[model samples]
Target: MLWIPIDRSLDIPLIRQVYQQIRERILNGDLQSEEKLPSTRELAFELKVSRNVILEAYDQLIAEGFLVTRRGSGTFVAKGTFLEKRVVPNHALNWRENKTDAANIIDFRSGLPALDLFPRKTWAKLSHAIWNDTSHSMFGYDLPEGRPELRQALARYLLKTRGVACHPEQIVITSGATQALTLVSRLLLSPNDTVIMEDPITNDIQTIFKTTGATIFPIPVDEYGIKTALLPENKKPKLIFITPSHQFPLGGTLPIQRRIQLIQYSRKTNCYLVEDDYDSEFRYEGPPVSSLQGLEPECVLYVGSFSKILSPALRIGYLVLPLQLIEESRRLKWFSDLHTPSVEQLILARFIDEGYLERHITRMKKVYKKRRDYLMHCIKTTFSNEVQVFGYSTGLHLIVEVTNFHFSKEKLKQIEQCGVKVYQVEEHTIEKDKHQNQLILGYGHLNQEEIKEGIARLHVALYK
Candidate 1:
């Protein structure tokens, strides 16, 4: 007789209990391969349960290849079903616990927008309207190139705002800018191919290209962006990654002279330039600079996302491809999740077409500029002549260069221990020890009070 226990107290179904125990026994090798079991009637009689419950459990086991029955014979365990359990480490649990403990830290992490200001009511209304009026075809598999409505809207908006010259067919909507970069990497790179990138670029971007097994050639940037004069003359790179409108971390708008030089270099080497226009929408100085793609559309691939302007939760980003790369890009995008969520794309299209996106940006720009100005004032007042600020004219974040301070790992941990978290510019540098005195401070997500308190905490951490 088989030994099976039952508990009527558990909220779990009796069938599930029976099924799990039998499955566990089989996998644990307690039940030998091809061993026969008591008939359903016999087991039901033994367990004092309904015959139908036993039958259902047996049926489930049979369906899962755990058990089989011969004609005119009893059921038997399937062969090769036993598996040795392996221990998994608790690192993930530990990480989650640590993350929970960081809730009180005043984090100055960059690349985040004012999430509290997201138009939730407007978005909800759009979502409801979309769900009500959407055609049946929209719920099914969509074109990998994304909805025509969204692409057309993007074309008009990008032309008017960023001076990017591209048709709707050339835009490929992606999950986010990260995916867009991945697609670009896959499209242009092969193992051992060379890529030229900014020295102090975002670490995530560097990691993405490195995953392609390509070597990244780092060109150092000054206050005016990449030293185009220092671009490698010996090697022909596959692609050149840059953030021209507002260079990340360092925040230099690539000067026109260097922009032309970069275009000339790409033309000479027949390499494409990947322009990441991340947070140019919130420029605090003059009007936003035109994208590098506008100068030479065929030689540049422009990547943009709504993460900085709206919310990263949207996960809506796009790549403006050259004419020659559109077909293959569409194929690659098709293979990558078979297009982004169709309903969200439709909603965003309506958002852009109705002028909601522009109005939101205009509103947020003022809010961010105020935060930026207040942060600058706080830093100057607190640090006096001890620190210098860089890249304050544009973007949601700026860099503060402290006189003779190196943000080593131990010092960073100490700062965090003081209820403050700040990012070091050295963490993003390709060549180490170059940007040790600099730190990136982001103000987009924090209100004025949080900003002031964060600056205060940072001051205590840095000086104390």
Candidate 2:
């Protein structure tokens, strides 16, 4: 039987869901070429749906060439519909799924928020209200720059929270920072154009630039963020991608002087600065760091996402672009996916407007701070002076450098075998053999007890 689970609670229609699932199975080879599909009557009986609904779904699929029917024969998979495997790049090998004992493992993976801390009840209320009352006109395509309400809500929110000066017209909602970077790469970069990026940067950013055929010049990042003094004096790249607020994998916030120098460098080179303020909501020490875009709105393209603060599953992010790049970015985004879903956008906008977002951030910050403190305590008690932590007091994760331990492949595998998972900063490094002794421990998603136990297991794995 071709089983397609239909959720009655979804806003999508039952017939559309059935059609989409069958089409997906055909495309993915789950339904092989020439495979017979069950009759509409049998499928209707099996799924407990109306026979007319099954007929409608099948009619659409057949009309779309995903299915075929003959007088004497039943429906079958289309002949040319078998998808061939395409070659993926070597860098994508990191995406291979790890088969682990899920019941006992402790994960310290980076880029995850504490999902347990999200305000699910409020989100559900907003979601239900939005779905129930939204205009039927919104069921169709929306503007590529996103819904006006969301952009406006984000404009006021950014001005108050991040000190970003932007009109709603300049904000383009993206799937997340990933798509925002993709849009920038597509719009600003040409083949062989030069780009300057942090050496130990987010792997996805590096891959995005590489995929766009940009010539990447790697700059070493220190404790104070990307070394502004080391920026090329003679040549200039089209863009400089940076994480100024609590740098990724290593926690260095660019100081005011460096930020000024970077803006100056961008101005001199006639280039743009891509400032990714990914996890700025959980600042634990010192005053909140202001965004570089606020310093010089004309020179910096600021990107932010809710994935770090609220929930990654929401797939909501925005780019505060300079006036010059606005049109092209929107055109590219339109060609990419038209726009993010309108219902979710309205829900998030409401979330911001109703004060739930702020309250959630304030509550989660304290929770994460406690987890951070407990993790630091455990690391101190376990490794003592043998370990040095970086990127502390901010962000969901911190870097732990164990002086005597080298995270070679074998060592990492051994640690994994012991049911503890911690990521190495060296994996994100562009220059080989740097930061090999450092590991990134993400505490946002784990409780204090898990943090202590995970570190203890890691300690045994490394020491034993």
Best by TM-score: 1
Which portions of model 2 show Cα errors greater than 4 Å?
A: 1-99
Give the top-scoring candidate (lDDT).
1
Tens digit per residue, CA lDDT, model 1, 267-328 = 99999999999999888888899999999999999999999989999999999999999999
Per-residue alpha-carbon lDDT of candidate 2 for residues 1-464, written as tens digits (9 for 90 to 100): 98989899999999999999999889888998889999999999999999999999999999989989988898888888878678999998888776878779999998799898788899999999998998899899899999999999999988888899999999999999999999999988999999999989988889998898889898999998999999998877999999998798799999999999999999999999999999988999865688999999998999999999998999999999999999999999999999999899999999998888888988988998999999999999998888998789689999999886789989998998999998889898888798889999999999988998999999999888
Candidate 1 residue 287 Cα shift, in angstroms, is: 1.7
lDDT of 1 at 6: 96
TM-score for every candidate vs. truth? 0.93, 0.81
Off by over 4 Å in 1: 1-9, 34-49, 70-73, 86-100
Instruction: List the RMSD of every prediction in angstroms.
Output: 2.4, 7.6
lDDT, candidates in the order shown: 0.92, 0.91
Clashes of 1: 0
